[model samples]
Target: MASRSFAEEDFSCPVCCDIFINPVLLSCSHSFCSSCIQRVWRNKTLKECPVCRTTSSNDHPPVNLALRNLCESFQQERKPKSGPGVCSVHNETIKLFCLDDQQPVCVVCRDSRKHTNHRFCPVDEAVADNKEILKASLERLQEELRRSVNREQKLCKTAGDIKVHAQDTETQIKDEFKELRQFLDDEEAARITALREEEEKRSQRMKEKIEETSKQISSLTITIRDIEEQMKTEDVSFLQNVKATLQRFVFVSVLLNSNHHS
Candidate 1:
């Protein structure tokens, strides 16, 4: 494969613009770094190919094993050889470290006037010490990352809880409003019923008053007719019944005054 040359871009991921790391293939025949594709799809509703924008059928796309092997081979071929370094000053192999100068040096440089009084240590020891320091730094960074991750998780949980609380509060508000609406409806009905009952009572009283007035008017009319008939009688007959007629007239006058006052 190395004999058949290929461009670096051919093995690169479109999303990361770097050599594919754990490449995954989509059904659309496009590939991307697994982490890059997952990052792109994190906030999206549908999984899709990054280059083609084609929807993916599977959530966990298959790893491109052939492409991965090729990339690994390519990386190995491109890696620089780590042979013993040559000293710029003595042109000898660098095998020691100058503690005072803080630089790698050849054995010949250790005896030179420039490093005569400088402390020295083996390159291996220096390397081991530096690795230990780096390891400590890496541990601190990992601890901080863990704390950050835990905080983020807690925040996400709180957000979900807040959403649930809001839904519950909204439901409670709706239920309270429904109860208030029912109460108002009942109050309005009661008021209307009371008003209707009062109106009926007043109407019944008015009807009774009208009927009594009609009967009084009818009685007055009959009395007036009787008096007129008596007036039409012969002179001798009218004179003989004058006293009874006067008494009836006085009774009618008293009835009219009573009716007027009432």
Candidate 2:
């Protein structure tokens, strides 16, 4: 009795304050009844160990088979009474489960008219079958979840690629515009240089033409003065000067006509 008491104290689940039922092991090596742990963490966002408060990294922790076996062995040694779990209606031990009604029923209820044409199974068998169905469903849900995550990742990568492509296109456009602007600037500089050179050439030609016209005017004035001084002298001197003055006048008339044509 003393050993049994000690074992009960050691094996009792912390959450339920009872012997472990379907114990599961966490990463921290702590053990608890599956139902008790689920209840503690139910509707919670973060999964954590109830005893140590350590966060669990795994979505589903493994079952503690050794601990479960120990709990079963301990219960068997304790020799639980059959009457405590008996059906109140039939006054018999509940050994079978009603598949249609989804409840436990005694042998009398199984044969009764209320359960007519209904499927039935032993309690242990029903538990095992239900567990299998639940496990298969869980696997299907997990597969769907994994597919959703993969799709999300692919979409993110595609979006990133599109952004990078857009940036590259923008840079190319800017570079092309820069080249165009530089070409325009260089063309403007060349045109301005050509215009300045043409202006300088035109100005130099005008200066040369002005100097030549001034020299022609000075020569004409000197010829006129010589003719006037000779006219004041005697008739023979005036006649000799008249021939030179006529030649000078003809030369000045030809120069003025040439200048007008130019």
Candidate 3:
């Protein structure tokens, strides 16, 4: 059995939504009309796939020769036969367009009872006028596409900028925290050093005071022992030395008072 013929959609270009014309293939495996892709990329900075939105590395993609040949063959196969342009009712060549019916009719059909009050114009003239209207419509659509592409580009750029800003802000925060940490560490070290110095100074002063107090205690102990020894002496000898002993006792009392004050 013969295989079924390929559908029209197989030869269609995604960009033009029509039969491929001079199709070009991107590295991403998508194909579009060369003119259509060029027009899409004309006002853009980066080249991208229209359907998938994939970024393309190549500015000028290679021609899809196999696809282009298929498109050409499909167009040839769908072309209207020459005799089909004749009107079936009048069996005449269709040269006029019925404005009311909006269909092509032969010269005889233009005056038929069915089209008595219908407006008519030459097929060529009507085709030209309609072509102009279609051209205008196509231009409007293209303009709308350009605007949409511009908006997409702006949105993409904004997203990239936002990402960059977030990264920079994060880096800045980390740096600031690092500096703060360093400052805190330095302050802590400085306070600890000051405390240690103060401790050393106070410890030395305490040691000196203890040594002086110890020397005073030793002197008082010697004076006490001498007094006790003199108390054991005979009463007559003790009476004779009592004046000198009293003077010595008065001197020792003064020393004790001074040590107490210090």
Candidate that scores best on lDDT = 1
Which sections of candidate 3 miss by over 4 Å? Answer: 1-84, 112-116, 179-262
List, residue by residue over 1-262, the lDDT tens digit for candidate 1: 7414877778888986667889999999898889888888998898978777799998889999989988887766664432236564335667787778667777878886468799988776765654454344344434443543554456556555555665565566556556677557676556556655655665566555555555655565565556556556543344335446556656755775685577
Cα-lDDT of candidate 2 = 0.64
Write down the TM-score of every candidate. 0.34, 0.33, 0.34
Q: Which residue pairs does candidate 2 place in steric collision?
A: none
Tens digit per residue, CA lDDT, model 3, 79-125 = 43324466654357777777787677788787764688999887667
RMSD values, in order shown:
50.3, 51.1, 50.8
> Top model by TM-score, which number?
3
Off by over 4 Å in 2: 1-93, 181-262
Candidate 1 stretches greater than 4 Å from native: 1-84, 108-117, 181-262
What Cα-based lDDT does every candidate model obtain?
0.66, 0.64, 0.65
Score candidate 3 by TM-score against the native.
0.34
TM-score winner between candidates 1 and 3 = 3
Clashes of each: 0, 0, 0
The 10-residue segment of model 2 with minimum total lDDT is 234-243
Enumerate residue pairs that collide in model 3: none
